[model samples]
Target: MEKWDVVVVGAGPGGSYAAKTAAELGLKTVFFERGRRPGDKNSSGCGLGQRWWRDFPEIMEALQGLPSVRKVEMVVINLVDENNRLRYRCGTTGSDLCANRWPHGMDGISIYRRDLDPFLADLAVKAGAELRTSTLVSDVIMENGQVKGVRTEKGEPVYAQVVIAADGAMSTMARKSGIRNRWGGGCTLVPQLDFSADPDKMDDVIGNAEWVWFGALYGAYQVNFRDGFHIGAGQWLREDWDEKPTDMVKKVLQFPAFQAMCRAIDAKPREYQAHLLPWLKKPPKTYTGGMMLVGDAAGFPCPLEAEGIWHALTSGKIAAETAAWAISRGDTSERALSEYERRWKASPLGKEHEFGPEFVDLWNSTIFDPKLMARQIQLLLEFSMLHPFSVVFDWGDAHMDCFNQHLEHLLDLAPQFADFGRTYLAPLARGIWPKNVKRILLSVKPRIPVLGKLPDNTFLRLVAKLSKSLAPYLDPAVNQEAPLPREVFERSRKG
Candidate 1:
């Protein structure tokens, strides 16, 4: 039996990053991958958020050198009628908010996991983390009610002072370790197709943009890459909706917009993949005695968008830091490891996860529901197609009247939607009432002449104040300024 300081299961972003950080900190870390290679089992209609680079500048530098990555400049939300004609389209191009936020000046990088995962795993290797492939961690090694390490499928025992489970949504380590019993009902089944197309044609058609289709039961997204594109459909599954995920994929492919995009690029299907995405209302238990969980295994996927890569990388680094801290103190008990949970809760990942449910509720009521979304799209189309001369000479009273009528209709349904939102959102989150009220006021402010002209700083200040008042309710664990354990800080400095 070979003993190590840390053992990481699964070599996805979470596990690889964990291994990398721990190894770089002078810990003897081992990373395991069940597939023949790191990304063989992974699938994503991948858009790596710009925040990843903003937080990890080293990663940004590395990604810049990769041929598989594409800088995405535009993200479009589209509503297409049944006939496949574009009904409404809204998007931001260059100089978007993301470009303004990050020095890198791009929204995100679109990628293929086959290239990304392997590249990330290699980073761990270069950082001195031992890599093992074709190894399945079948169970955690436990004794006297604490995890000691893991057992491989071939019955080889690997011992470690700490184990990090990054095995994904259906994490065997999490279940077997009794940290979690089962997955929740709020899971998404995403079925996707990978296609190879002429790069010139793809560039012309996609033009550094990503497209998301609304007004469909299974919402679809199209992401362009260097040599290809990934088109996928996602459906949030509840008990009442029993359709198979593959069937949903087939149905989404029938959409006219998807068909047109494929035809335009002359795409040839290269692969079909499906994966389970966890959308927990709150993060699951991430730590126990001598063990910790990160990434999808810990249910850290973004609740609103189901984006896991950002959370995966962020949590992986945090877990490694926590593990190193506990090790330096020579304590691997559940209590010591609990700091992992505390740190993550105080990090940016925590803030995003905490607010996920509220965003989901807003999205579901305003955009996810096809009927409501269709009506809204129709209104936008009508407004855009109106003649400019009629607006200037005819005084636009008729246009105003039509708009007011539509507004009245929406207002009439507000109470019903509010009731539904309360019921639906209550279980997933708290402190939504104040946020909802603020959102409503902001939406209406644009229609008020004077208020609409007010500087952006006014609304920003109002939000800042609201956040201060609501902090306790939104996150009970708000200790962002707490000092790190003395020993951990010393060791980090030495490393």
Candidate 2:
């Protein structure tokens, strides 16, 4: 048996970081990469978040020399329907589409996995950790319910004081060590298409901003780097996948604007790949006996963005810290390693998941379905991002037509808001709210009209009043009586 202080499985971002941190902490560290090299198994590329720039300065220093690095301060988002009709467009760094209070502004880095992994692995090697590329950890070595280390596919056993499993989302080590069984709903499948674009044309057309297309293919996105761009889409995995990810990627490429953009930039697809990523809606068991799981194996992806590099990096370092502490104390049992979960939860790594449930609702809602999302996006545009611009520009009859349609939609949605009160607010009022007042409010949730909760006659009157207020400024070309309150009531009653 070969013995070491720490054995880090899988040379992904989390595994490399664990090896790096463990070695820096004076532990005998070794990381295993099943691929020929660190980045070989990863999808082509994706964006790395603030944690890479702000939290890990050493990694930043290591990344400085790489050509694959492209730092961005803006992002472009497009919402399109199945008909190839563009529904809405927004940009993070745009001038006042809607006001926000982000202190850091929008900032991130786009890099290929091929570029990121090798350098990150090299950082660990530089910190005096051993690198074992092409080494597959087939199972973990356990003795009397305690993880002793890992066993290679070759059946060579490597013993260590602590084992950190950072393998991909479907981690064999995690299952073999009894941390978690295989997943059905806890992960997503992402299919990627890698393209080499004309660099100059890419800068001209794509620029430095990442482009996200929602509804055209929900969770569909593209990020530009030095010489190429990557397009990908993802959805949660079910036991029997209703939609094939490869088929979805092909359809995404067929989308009118996406295909046109490819033609403009002279893009050529060089690779098509797909992989599983963790998408945990609830907290996961990350530690057991002498083993700690980090990154994908531990389910640390962001709820909204579904990005995991930040979580991986942060959790990997924290897991290593726990390993170091436990090893020094000579207690490598489950009790000692449980601190790994504690430290992560106490850190931003865990707090980032606070809105997991809410976001997961959006992830599965009609908000991601192209046709249904189009209707919702129309509402969002009418009320928010597009409102200010419509105010300044005289878009003529088109604008008035939209105003009328939006009023109708708003009227349609009023009842749904009442349902919201019933589903969400009513139950909560039972606990914290006063009984009499709670009756007025408990009174709420699920799905009822927004104003439908009000005395029936009083509803939609607000919209008519607003229309009357704006009636004077409008030209005769626009119909002021379209959304009249009495007319709306008559329509509803007739139905």
Candidate 3:
């Protein structure tokens, strides 16, 4: 039996980050993982949000050219018939593609979870956290009606004043502790089929492009190309909870529309993996007597686009900070820990969960209606192709600062989303600009379109009417205060 200050379960980005932050903060941290090595059992399409570099610059520096870093700049949305023949298709740039806009015009790289996860874990070790892989936490240890520690499979007792569950979506600790009881219809099953091949053939075409296919019962169809060697389809689904990864890959490969998109780059399935994700929602509760949850266990999914890695890392950091603060105060009570939830919601972390439900409602409605989905995909394609410039951000020296300012602007829009009803232009502007440019665009954008369809006058009229209301927020002082880093912007432009 060993007593530690904080115990993090799971070694994914969320867990590793939590441990690293905790240890660096001088907390006695112990990380328990079920995998043989740090990243042994992991599988992911590995698309990260641009925010990754903002918080964990070290991870980005370490993984700059790793084998799993998948690059994407263009996304093509297509409708595949039952036989996998493509009936309709559209392509657009990473800059203006509103699907999952990046701030700062930054494009995401898909890294192998197998490599990336371990790298983060090793970094945590370097930061002075104890890493214990192959340690399965079988049950949580409680006393005085509060969580005090956990019991591993071999019956070893590891004690901690505060417990953070980064155990991922099917969190056994969460279920055991009564934190999460169920997942909503918003859960997305991302089934991916991975392929490894020659860099030239793969990188030249797949390197710059990613695709989403509509009409599949499982969810959205995605092709992510990584490091010019690994390519996979992250097929999304809101239903068919019973389908296995192998079957999902089989069905997707047979889809006529999916086949057509694959033909352009010559892709084939080499390996298959499955991931079940819960939608963004307020966890039933994040804090208990002496315990809390982070990452997937806490139910913070990437709100609008189902991106989880960034959110997971963000929540993990928040949880670690909360734990550190609580321990320093000699208090791990529910009241002290409540600060974690409050702070998370106060920042973009909270907004991510808030916007998740709306996405769920829209995706659910559209997933079942193939024709409707096709039409929406068509509109997206049309928008991407016709208005590629606005949708893409090619800023030379102003990339990073511009993006940060933009994100700050979007955060400003948070308080107004409820008052303006559906006329919110933030998403439309964001989806169209680089994530870094999104907030800035939102500040100036008057009419925000929802669901990709709006009357031309509808948005302009709303903007005109709201101009006076928005004048105070968009003062010149705000714009001139700071811009993104010029060097990164210039380099990105060159690249």
lDDT of 1: 0.77
lDDT of 3 by residue, 110-179 (tens): 6677778988898889999999999988878878767888889999989998998988888888877766
TM-score per candidate, chains pooled: 0.80, 0.80, 0.72
Between candidates 2 and 3, name the one with more favorable lDDT.
2
Model 2 / residue 26 / CA error / Å: 0.4
Best prediction by lDDT? 1
Runs in model 2 deviating more than 4 A are: 94-105, 367-386, 397-495
- The sequence of per-residue lDDT tens digits that candidate 1 reaches over residues 306-412 is 88888998999999999899999999999999999999988988877766656666556544455565554544444444434434444446867855655566576
lDDT tens digits, residues 164-214, model 2? 999979889889999889775878888888999888898888887889876
**TM-score, predicted candidate 3 vs. hidden true structure:** 0.72
Worst 10 residues of 1 by lDDT: 471-480
